[model samples]
Every structure is written in C-alpha cells, then in structure tokens.
Target: MSGPITLRTQKALVTRYKNSLATAIVQGASVLANEESPKMLAIEATALRETAALVEKALENFTKTADGMEEITEEQDKQIQAYVEEVQAVVANAETLLIRIGAKRTGLQEATPMDEGRRPTVTKKTIVELPEIPIPTFDGKITDSENFWALFDASVHSQDLTGLQKFNYLLKALKGSAREAIKRYPITEANYAAAVELLHSKFGDKDKLIRSLQTRKETASARNSQLTEQRRLLDYLFALVTQLEQNGIVLNGSFVAQKILAKFQPDLQRRLLKQRVVQGNSEELWAVKQLLTDLDTLIKTEEQVSEMLPENEAFRGGTKGRPPPRRYETTSGQRSQMRQNLCIYCSDTEHNSLRCPKVDSARNRREFLKEHKLCINCGKPNHISRECLRSGCTLCDGDKHHFSLCPKRLPTALSSAGPTKSAYTKSSRTTQQPKRADAKQPTSSAKTGAHCINSENK
Candidate 1:
C-alpha cells in the first residue's frame, strides 16, 4: 500500500542507524573494559542490544522495500545498494562488539561466530572537507541584479541550507531598493518563503526587463570617434543576448548572427555579409570574432596611412558633408607660368617637344593636300616633290640658266610669291645685251643672287 522510499530518505535513515549503532557498541565496550562493576557493564550491554535490534529491524524493512520496488533507475539502484552495504557493515561491527562485550547477538549472523578470540578494531574515518560556497552581492543596479540572482539561486538550491538560512543569505546579498523592500518582514523561518514571494511580486517584471534590452544605433559622429559606438553596440548586444538566454528565449547561431549584423551600419553590414559569403556557413561566434578582427586591422591600417601622410594632406579631401576649398592661388600661379612658356606653333604650353610643330604642320599639310591636291614642285598632283624627275634648274625649274646663276633669285616678296615671272624677264634681258657686256653684268647679278638665296635659306 505504501509508496517507494526516496533515495534521500533511505540514505538519511541508513546514516542515522549506523551512527547510533556505532555509538552504542563503543559505549558498551568501554563500560565492560573500564568498569569493574558488572551492573554497569550489563546496563551498557542492554542498551547496546536495544540499539542493535533497532538497526536490524530498520535494515530488514529497507531491504524488503528496496527489493519489492520495480522500475528503479540506475541512480536509485546504486543508492539502495550503497545504503544496504553500509547497513550490513554497521550490523557486522555491532555483532562483533556484542561478542567482545560478552553479550548475546540480537538475531544477526556473524562471519566468525565460533572464534571468540577474533576482536573487531574500530578504524577512524577520514572526513573530507568541501570548499565553501562563494556568496554573491547585489546592488539595485540591473546589471548587478542579473549576475547576483543567477549565482545566488544556484548556490541556494545546491547547498543543504534551511529556509531561514537561505533567507538570511539572500538578505546579506541584497542592497538599496531590493533590501529595503523586504526589510519590514519579520526574520522568521515561517516568513522566509512569503518574503521571497513578496520580493518577486514587487520587482519581477519580465516585460520591463525585456524592454530594457532595446537595440542601440550608432551615430555618424560616433564613427569619427574611433569605433566608440561599435564597442558600445557590441557590449549591449552581448548583454542583451545573455539576458534573453537567461529568460528562456533560445536563439540559433544564424539568428544571432543576423541580429548582430543588423546592428552594424550599412557599409559594415555589407562587408560582413561579403565575408560570410566567402567563409561559407560560419557560426555566429566565429563571424563576430572575424568581424572584430577585420575592423581592428582596418582601423590600424588607416591610422598608419594617416600617420605616413603630411598633416595638411591627411584630411585634404573633405568628408561627406563638406567640400574641400578650391586652391585658386596655386592654380592661377601655375597657369600664368604655363602661358609664359607656351609653344610658338600651337600657342599652348602643353606641347613643348620638337615633334609637336612637325605633327601640327603635317596634319595641316595633309588636310591641304587632301583639299587642293597640289604638289610643291610643279603645282600638279601627278607626284610628290621627292619623286619629281624633271631635268631643269634646281632653284627655279628653268633651262635658260643654272639654279645658282638665276637673276630672279632675290630676297623680295614678289620673288617669294612667283619666281617664274621674274625669271622670264631676267632671262630675256640677259639675251638682249652684248656677249662681252652680258658676261660682266652676269657676274654682279650672280653675286647678288647668291646673297639673296643665302638670306632666303636663313
């Protein structure tokens, strides 16, 4: 009709029985050896017999109940087995003590019943001391409250403390509003549970706690402050995630990764997204670590570049909201200098090489040739000047006189315009004069012609 005994209850009962039996046996042995009176020895032996009977009855009940129980878990089975072994060992010791004290065995079997010379020696057990639990303290601050409650709750549940003891420890950890809230309650074991319930009712608002973890946004100004906003955002997110987890809101790695990425600016988000794509199936923790590392490296590189540049040139290109001033003074000075050194052919300083004039002339000449189709030598398009094979005076294209002796070769505008007309007149005049006079006149004309030709060449 009765339910199965819990491991805790069974262990407690077994421990108590062992302690009582050991105490009674030690007392009986001490009285029998030290006391000269048979009356005292008999009285101690009687007490020992009663204690042994109690232990034996309890062991019998435990064994019957443990054996009858079905559907026992491994942990329960181990507990029951350990309890039985301990009880049996205690009973054996009690029997040996009874035999030594010259008392009758209380319905318990002994291994060496006939050997009365074999005496049992009690060995002192080595007690292992456990380390003390550290108590957490909490102020009214939300951050402190969260950390303290987690540790405090774990410690209270794990330790074998009474209700009053738990309440006292809780009070010792509280401060400010939390401590004040429960101060009016009487400090009694009966009121401990009520006090805890009242404290929770007063302060525990899940919605408010959840709302406190609102997403924080970084400002544009904060960007110039060397990642101050980013650091703040990261800390807030980590705390928010931890708080959410504590509240039993389980989030997956991808979901957390998305949440973290969402908090970043558009540029940073895009960069991190690209990185994630490259990495392929990275977890939230790894993504965050890699993101932070990249940001740090980028910041360091920028700082190094900025350091390398001259202070005046470092911020020369103004940022988004502002435009750099136009440097008119330096620009105007450079323009004036360029104008002074401008090319004679093109009237531009951009062209300073010998090829520039040649290129300009060739382009113009080609255009002219294409339009008029004229040759430089005979005013005909049959061939170019270089391929002209007509046999005549080299200077004027005349057969009457050699090119050097041509009288029309003068440094005059008319000569430059049309030398053929002047050549005809000079040739006719040379023919009309006498041969003797003509020879003398031709010498002066020849010298004059040579001088004019040299001047034209220059």
Candidate 2:
C-alpha cells in the first residue's frame, strides 16, 4: 500500500534510529550508574535494553531494504540480524555493568510514552533562567580597589555563576591601571581566578595602606572651605583606620584622636586643649566630629560679630571720620601751639564757654561783650557802643553818665587826653582865677577840673 522508500529516505531512517539508540544507551548508563536504589537501577536498565532492541529492529529493517530492493538475500538478512544482535548484546552488557556498580533508576531516566501509530515528537531544549548580579568597577586606586573587591567577593559568594561568567564580570569592571594589568590574559575560567588573585596581590598591601593613612593629615586652614575639606579628610582617615583595625592592626583610639587634633589651627588647638582639661572626659577628646561642631560654632559666632561691628581702623593705624591734625607755621619759623580753649559756643581761643567766669557775673560780662565790640546795654552781640539801648552807665548803673565817663570806673591816661568840656563852656563858666590871653592855660589841668565837675553832676 506504501510507495517504495528512496535511498535518501532509507538512509535518513537508518541515521535517526542509530542516533536514538546511542542517546538511550548514554542516558540510561548515566542514570543507572548514579542511582542509589537497586530496584530503580534494575528498572532503568530494563527500559534501556528494551528501547535499544526497538532501535536495533528498526535499523535491521532499513538495512535489509537498502538500494530500493524490497527483499534481501539470506546472506544479507543474516548479516543485518547479526549486527542488530551484536548492538543488543552491547546494550545488555552496559546495563549489567551499571547494575554491578549499584546504579539506580531515577526520574531523569524515565522514558516518555509513545503513540502506537505516530512518530515520536522531539522536545525542544529548556532554557535556564539565571539571577542578575551587579558588576563592580575599579580604577586602580587603593580606596576604589578596597570597595570594589569587597562588593565583588560578596557578589561571587551570593550568586550562582560559573567561573567563566565571574571572569567576564570581573573583566567588565576593570578600568584604568587595573584593566591594563589583566588585558593580556585570555578570557577563560582559569585565567579569571588567576586575574583576581593577581589583582589582590597588586593592590592589597595592608601595611602600605596603613602607612599611607598614617601620613594623611588635614591640610586645610580654619575657614568654611577648610572646615569642609578637613571633615572630608578626617572621615577618610577614620574609614582607613577601621579598615586597618579589621585587618588585625591595633590602633589606639586616643592616638587617633591626638592625630586628628593636630590638624586644627593653633588657637583652636589651644581652646580644645583647654576644654579637654576642663571637662576631663576621656572619650572623643580630640575627635574631629566634636571639634568640628565646636569650630563651626566658633566661626559662625565670629562671622556674626564681624558683621555687626565696624572695621577696625585702629589696626590700620588711623582713625575714622577724622583728618590729620593741621600744622600751622608761626612768623618766628616755629610751629604754632594747638589752641586748647576752643569755645564750643562762641568759638573763642582765650577761654572755654563752659567754664567762662564772665558768663554769670554782670561786672565781668562786659569783658566778652567789649571783645566783640557788642552793646553792653541790651546784651546783644555785634552792635557798636553808640547803638546801645541802656541810658545808664554800664559799670555803676547810673542813668546820668555813660559807661566811658563813669567815676566808679578807673580812667586810663587816654581818658584825660581830650578836653572833658567844650572851650565855649570853659570860657563862659565863672571862675575865681583868670588867665592872660598870651599865657595859655594847660589843657591837661583844665580837663581834670572839667572831669571833676561832670562827676559831681552825675
């Protein structure tokens, strides 16, 4: 009922049956050898031997019908049967060997059931899902290397990655000097471990790192920027100290505190030192955290105070709002002395108005008034004597005589220089003594007599 099988078709069938028998033999032996239970191992061996027989029969039928011939001679048939029997014997021997080794049949060896009249379906291979791992990067710096190695080691231990996968991840993370060191090595599982070991050797010098950390000191001055920088340096040192201590180095906390305190300014150092003595607290005595808090507060207070006060001109050797003292040259080529009694009210050089004795005394008041040629009558400054409002003498308060002619006041020689009375009054007044016209009367004697008469009238 079926068309004759072509040579190509027959060959394909033979190859397919041979591959199926090979696969069953390999899988069965693997499972049987690995199985612990004797019963399971026997079961798998029996299934494997049966599958091998079916494969052998299929191969025999194809070989007999080779070259498109429907029938094979007795010799050809016997040969095909002999070959199939030999394969069966080999499968049986393999099963016996597996059983001898105490192999048990496992679920892995369980064969799928086939349809009676349908070809066996080929199953596709299943894809396995792997967990994601974060990669680490390194720049060859000691700090970066420390961080990277820590994370890399953790990742390797946590993830279910093969050696080759780990190597690839390590290579991906390499950069700068680190990348160059391992660049020549082949990308392989063995090389990955070696590269990692090499990196550890190159960058993992604990003593060198400790020495470097010991040398680090805060280089910044005491300021806002310096505070930021100092804090960063101190933090770095602390991290380094922790790392060294973990690696079995015994670092004293007090020693570390002393080292940190050495970085501050001299004034800050003195202050902190004083505080330490006063508090007597041994803990965190020179710790940067506490010192930084104090320093920050100090600097902030200083800034606020500075903002409130004017600049220190004294420090600059000058006074604000005042000019240099004026130097006056005298006629004798000597410097004039500075005026001491500069009056605040009247601006006089002779006396200060505050302590001026003439201010309250009526008799001495006219001295100041006369200096400015002011009227003594009304007490107003800047007016002449003739413009005076008072009709009385300034010295004696007499209404009949002017201040210049008052008898109570002493007369200078200049007061007698001019005649007190007019020549007409002198000539008309009755006198007991008469004088010749040629012999002139002394004007001084006549003026004196006239002053006497005037004083008597007042």
Candidate 3:
C-alpha cells in the first residue's frame, strides 16, 4: 500500500511492462524498505516493478447461477406442498399435534377430552381393527390404515392423532425436527442422524427403539429404514431450495417445483383436490384456488441456487466450463497511449495480435507447412482454416454438410423439436385452483378437475 508520488510516472511504464504506475510506486517503496538491494537511479527502480492491470482484473471473475424452480397448481399439488410444509413443521416441533402411541412411543399424552358437537355419524363400514400381525402387512393385513371397519364399529375415532399420525410416528422416531431445520439447506447424513436422536425425546430413548426395531424383525426393518431415508431426501430438497433463496434468482418456489419427476408429487394425499371438485358445483371454488396461489409464494428473499450441486440426474462427469473473457474500455487518452505494436490477446508491444495476419491466411504459409496441415478441399488438416468452412465446403455427403467429425452443441435430438409436455409440467402439477370461472356458468376448467386436497376429487 505504501508508495511515493514520483514512482507512478507514466514514462517509467511505457517502455517496459505497460503496467499501472501505482504498482511501480508500491514496488519502489518495498525495495527501499527491505534495504537488502543497492541504491539505484529513479528510472532504473521504476522499470523493475511492472505488471498488467488487465491481467489482475481478468483473474477475478466470479460468476452467479440462477435457481430453476417450476410453478404449478393442480388439486394434488396443494396437498403435496402442504404435506411437505406440515412434515417440516411437525418435525421441527414448530407446531405440535396430539398423536397416538405406537411401539417406541410407549409414553403417551392422554387424549384431550372432547365436548360433543357437530360430528360425523358413525356407521358399520367406518370402523375396522388393526390386528397385531407379527409382521406388518402393507396389503391384506389388518393394519391401522385398514382399520376403518373396526374403528367405526367400536365408535372410536383416534382423537389424539392427526391424519399424518400413522407414518409420522415412524418418522418422528427416526428423524425428529432436525430434518425440518434443514428445510433451508442441505444436511449431511451424520447431521440427519443426530437430528433423529434429538427428535426422539418424549417418544423414549431412540437407541432402545433402534435396537428394538432391529432385534424384533430384521427383514422388515430394512423396508422401514428405507422410509426414513426417503423422508431425509425430502428434507434435502428443502435445503437445496433454501440455499437458492439465499443466492440465485430462481424463477419460482413451490412443492411442485422440487418434485420434478411426478413420482414424488404426493398424489395420494389429495383430499382438498377432491373437495374442490364437489364445490365447483357450488360457488367459491375460486377462493379455494387462492389458497394454493399464496402457498407457493414462500419464495425466499435471495434467488439463484446454482452454487449448490445441480440436482439434475443427467449431469455427467463433473467439469464446469471456464468463464468468458473480460474487457473494460479505456479512456481516449489511455487508448491513444496503448501500444500500436501489441497483439490483441496479449497487449505486449512486439506485434499487434488483431493485425497478426499470420494467424489467418497464406501470409503464414510457413506455419501451415510446419504443422503439416493442408486445405480440407485439397485433403489437409492443419491448413483447413475455419473461414474456409463458412464459405461452404465441397465435402457435402451425409447430413453433416460441413465437418463430418464436428459434434452438435445440443445433446438430445428432441431438444430442437419445438415443444413438449415438459413446458407445462410445473403448472399442471401444483394446486388445483378452485373453479375461478364465474358461478353463472361453469368453465371447461372446472369440469375437468381441481388439485385441491381439501375438496374436489380430481
């Protein structure tokens, strides 16, 4: 940082490095401070401390990436987003739910007493019992999910449990709120495991549950383990989105955006989607659509999550390309003072690069001879200049009318084929907006179906 005014003179730089005078001054100060070298004249000292400002600027190029989230609204879409948020909230214990006791949840909070009010009428088919099968059967087994017959027959609706109680308890035992904390960023497996231990507080000692689950049924335990892993993946997605909000200018943020492969869209939870359908027959379906519109609006303050590892499965061996060149205009005086003999790429004052005709034509015949390349028209490699191809080559045989060995910039054949279903994927998968069409006459949209998990069946 230290330098004298005299060292920055323009004359000292023009003959040598064509560097910044400020740099020369700083180097002069450094040499005098060290005192290891002998004394020198002002001109001699200035010549030694030369460097390019252009090179310094070129070395500092940092690029930014954009977040690429899709937006959609369908009956099933709202359900999935809400379900994801609910899962996060539940796991974070940001909100609490009255839940039922299961294997590890031996300690239970008694169900809050209820005052009878308007309630659904109990019927025979509504109740069913979950048999204590030594092995929990997903299909034919009498399980909690299938216990409608026994539950209603006994006039027993599990008062303490939320709709998510069945699968969440398993997750709660394995995951806890730690998974939700990562909704804003990615978490390592070690962190996820620790979060699981933190979440199993009231449920009981988690180590014991893990031991029990392992000791009791070794085979089914693997399937059960897979479920927790899936939930962790969901958390990782949230983390990815959160990081984007802190960085890139992503297009949009919604549950539909994360689950690009419709496989993860949570279609089974579309209770609201069905409700929207029935209510489309009535008025106010429009209001229902608004709910989803707002839910997708949880976009963070920042955008662009490009720094995060790309989630695209198509990414091949990881090698990002170098950034483009950097150019800044110099003032008229500086431009005038610029070297007339310098090359365009390297501004050294030997020979101007732009006027270096040797790089282009027959003027550099010796270069072509040395490389052993001849013109493509005349059967050659090194001498076939790019300019020759632009003029159109005679090597027109197959589809490659030009360079036979040249590859395409695009990857897939379909990329250039105009439109496809992918363009509408985001819109088709989000909240199923309530019938926004005037109640006076139902529109084609209402008739098709809404994605609301609240009402409409579609």
Find the candidate with the highest lDDT and give its number.
1
The best-first sequence of candidates by lDDT reads: 1, 2, 3
How does each model score on lDDT? 0.53, 0.52, 0.30
Clashes of 1: 0
User: Which runs of model 3 end up more than 4 angstroms from their true locations?
Assistant: 1-226, 251-261, 265-458
Query: All candidates' TM-scores?
Result: 0.32, 0.33, 0.13
lDDT string for model 3 (221-243, tens) is 11111222323433444443343
Pick by TM-score: which candidate is best?
2
* Residue range 1-458, candidate 1, lDDT tens digits: 32464534655676787799988877777775676454565567678777866775666566656666777789987776666656656665665555445432221223224476644431111122245467787666554556666788887635565554566567667777987787566444566788778666666666656555433212212333223355455555555656766876555566655655665445555665686679785565454434545655544454577568763333211133233666664677796676445432233344431222322233333333334444433333433444333344555654432222233442332233333222112234445321221233447889999999999999
Cα misplacement distance, residue 249 of candidate 2 (Å): 3.6
**Candidates sorted by TM-score, best first:** 2, 1, 3
Q: Any runs in candidate 2 off by more than 4 Å, and if so which?
A: 1-134, 217-226, 253-256, 266-271, 281-458
Residue 393's lDDT within candidate 3 is 33
Query: Which stretch of 10 consecutive residues in model 3 shows the poorest summed lDDT?
Result: 59-68
lDDT, residue 11, model 2: 49
Residue pairs in steric clash, candidate 1? none
TM-score of 1: 0.32
Candidate 3 C-alpha error for residue 264, in Å: 2.1
